[model samples]
Target: MVDLNAALRPADAGSLQPTAARPPARLQIADVSLQYGGKTPTLAIDNVSLEVANNEFCVIVGPSGCGKSSLLYLVAGLTDVTSGTIRVDGRPVHEPGSDRGMVFQGYTLFPWLTVRSNVEFGPRRKGLPKAEYRAIADHFLEEVGLTAFADSYPAALSGGMKQRVAIARALANDPSALLMDEPFGALDSQTRTVMQKLLLRVWEHTQKTVLFVTHDIDEAILLGDRVVVMTARPGKIKAEVPVPFARPRSISLVLEPEFIALKKRILGLLHDEIDETH
Candidate 1:
């Protein structure tokens, strides 16, 4: 098992530590819905309610057009809900606040910025002192094992490395919740496996509330403490499956009997959705 804290430096003075005893943040999405309007308005997401426990890694999975990502957007405060509310740590989310950090499938890094500078952008933008943001950037880059590439630009990195930078950049902000939308979907199988382990290690170390959206059943089952499967368009919760595997999960767990059984069950549920779509 990888020990994430082993290689990292201590948090800067007055910064939150990975093992700090702060109250873990909880995310609640209640009766949420989203509709895009014009001549013919379309309801993208139906009445959906879900609660993610403090520091829990919750993964959402479904077929394409199921509005899994839309639900994520609502939580990130990047889109307005047609109706309903989203709360973070009991406070209603009205706008995109630093409390929520998002990592999209595309590496949204600034092409011209070095990896270190890109990670520091959030803190600097918030008017943090140079020393504080520099420390923040260094801590996260080290945690992601990208310290050596601090001066490297995005265009010079591989897909996996770019995503690593993206993850580092998100964490540099020290958000209570981390929202990821198919963050590893674009990687090849080999690289994706490595990234998964790295992500689990990061999640274990940071203890941030995670809401990850993915289409792969295996990936969802492997990462989430609970996996919520959605129905077809105008997405509503179809089923919520709890992952029974132990923590510090490895890719090899996918070969185990328990993992195989859970995968089949989720696949069965998804197949029904696909049938209805046709």
Candidate 2:
């Protein structure tokens, strides 16, 4: 019998301990709320606050329509918050900027662009020297194991391959934080698992701050330093469960007893929120 409560304890600041010269949070959200205005205003997110440390990987999970994706969009500056603030590296986010890179569930790649071209889009847009941007694209393409497909168009690649290009494209921009919203939601189980491993490898190498949104509890645990659970619609922070596992994690971690205990605990939390809604 594992102590589920103990397993879900808040993460110790072991690796994240701040010093006098430490930088501000890489990503910060304070009292964020999003309400769609109309005859009947609908509040999607309510007073949700979160902070992601530099190089930390945080994942948000919740039931359907819980505004998990909405919160991520607010951070990406794709939608305005009704009230509150979102900051990246101590600067407020007003609109989409090069400082943040977004990857959606859909491939969202330009069909006409080849894999290398798609990855170079951001650097090219920033007026980087063609040679420099091409090098950047080549580097990330290799990182995601897409070097062989560099010249293949998005139409020529499979779903998993397209997403690898999408990730490579996001990282090429060299954003302060990587924001992903269910980026693997469209893939089959086997492909999703492979992408998960690939992403972990790239993330370990880049060490970029990440805020990923997903409903999959297994993924949230496997990929995040902290798993933030949101309440039902009109989402609010339900809990933050720190992952106790050590890094350089492999798929086999999922088979361990500790991982199973944590999953059950988080699943229970989600079930409670769901029950309240009905």
Residue-by-residue lDDT tens digits, candidate 1, 1-278 = 32323212212221212234323448878788899999999998888887777888989988899899989998999999999989998899888988899999998999999999999999999999999999999999988889999999999999999999999989988888999999999999999999999999999999889999999889998998777888899898887766767788888999887778778888888899999989
C-alpha local distance difference test of each model: 0.86, 0.90
- Clash pairs, candidate 1, are none
Best by lDDT: 2
After superposing candidate 1, which stretches have Cα over 4 Å from the reference? 1-25
TM-scores for the candidates: 0.90, 0.94
List of clashing residue pairs for candidate 2: none
Name the runs in model 2 displaced over 4 angstroms: 1-6, 10-24
In terms of lDDT, model 1 sits at 0.86
RMSD of 2: 3.3
